[model samples]
Target: MKDGGINFISFSVGRYGVLKTFSEQDMESLLAAYLKEHPDALERMHFVMLHPFRDDDDEMSRSAREIHHVAKRMKFFQDYVARNPYDSTILINNPTPRSKLYLDFVHYVAALLGPIGSYEIFK
Candidate 1:
């Protein structure tokens, strides 16, 4: 389907609290490959960063550790994106239990990707 009026490219490169699952290098390589395939779509690319869900159990500890690693890795990602031949935006977020970040994230996708495309991406 046509992506509304704008050609929006949305990619989720990492999972919540899964630090080792995909390193920053892997994400950079993935984006590079994607850019090679869709050369004209880099200007509207949206890289969304999901907030890690922290529970009051063992998972909380894991989440803390993972977030620490992610904090460090994000700097490299930012540098690469800046030097690369693409105009993209990175949304960095830390969701608290009472925060409405999900709603904000949804709105961001809708605004950036358009209504029709946002629904598909939100799923």
Candidate 2:
């Protein structure tokens, strides 16, 4: 959603279990590369990492692990943004349960990327 001047995009991470494959290092490298390539991308993008719980194991360990990984990624992003003062970086958490399938996940993602008038849900 893009409201006033913000464009939001809702992307799912754990829908097909792809997030389970993403190591914390992979996330860090991706963010770093994204920032480096676009330079101004951070200023325009508000990234919302979403992890949807699957079953019992997901509810307990997997979800916690994913959150921890995301937290670390956010720390790296925050540090980078601090070093590059000109860039605007926003990272928000919106971990939901896969029980809602993907709808709840989309809503959570939208909330993270706030003040947006339009949004696209990418699975």
Candidate 3:
């Protein structure tokens, strides 16, 4: 539901291991098809893209590539918003557990999203 111009779209990408290429046309097509099948989707049509990130030395090496990928996705959504300007927010979650408790990826994601002010830190 939309309130004060903010619209939330919630979706989950299951762990099937097939990397799908994301593009503006692809997103539009997906939304169109989804709306056709489930009309209610049209009401909360903001897009959220979720993908896994594995921590490896190679992952650090590909920082530039990931930056480009994010830029392209942002541009695609920006263009979509231009045609249909609506308040939208993107919430990305990793949904993958770390092998070791020391590797708190959730904290990293939260920091990237912005301040989590005064949230209790538990051990």
Candidate 4:
């Protein structure tokens, strides 16, 4: 991305449910290293919260526990963004729209970058 002169990076944490896959420290360390390599990209990073859900029938039996789990994950994101050297944006896209999987993300990103931004999907 740095080689391509792309400064912005958008990442969604959990697409299915709020499950802890990586520890906060692990993610922070990884991001810190990448940021160190491309210091200018720090302010352009965006962490998206997409499709936050709870598997009530199986994984999480209690509604209270599910809510707590989601809350904890959200806090994790908040803390992660807060620790960054540059102010980053957090886009909470709860109940993710189907269009987002299609062309919406491209359009959104294009809009953010204005007329100069362009994206092409590779098959």
Q: Compare the candidates by TM-score and give the number of the best one.
A: 2
Tens digits of per-residue lDDT for model 1 on 1-123? 024556443343432222222343544443444445545332333322221243334543333343333433455444534433232354365333112222322233334344332423331
Whole-model lDDT values for every prediction:
0.35, 0.38, 0.32, 0.33
- The CA lDDT at 68 in model 1 is 36
Q: On residues 47-67, what C-alpha lDDT tens digit does candidate 3 reach at each position?
A: 111213333445433432333
Q: Report RMSD (Å) for each prediction in the order shown.
A: 15.9, 15.5, 17.5, 17.1
Worst 10 residues of 3 by lDDT: 96-105
Superposed Cα deviation of residue 105, candidate 2 (Å): 14
User: Candidate 4 lDDT, tens digit per residue, 15-84?
Assistant: 2222123343434443344345545332232211121243323322232233233333444444534443
In model 4, where do residues sit more than 4 Å from their true spots?
Answer: 1-19, 46-123
For each candidate in turn, the TM-score is 0.22, 0.24, 0.22, 0.23
Off by over 4 Å in 2: 1-18, 47-123
Clash counts for all predictions: 0, 6, 0, 0
In TM-score terms, candidate 1 sits at 0.22
Candidate 1, superposed: residue stretches over 4 Å from native: 1-20, 46-123
What's the residue-level lDDT of 7 in candidate 4?
46
TM-score of 3: 0.22
- Ten residues in a row with the worst lDDT in model 1? 97-106
Better model by TM-score, 1 or 2? 2
Could you tell me how far off, in angstroms, the CA of residue 60 lies in candidate 3 after the best superposition? 4.5
What's model 3's lDDT at 120?
A: 26
Model 1 clash pairs are none
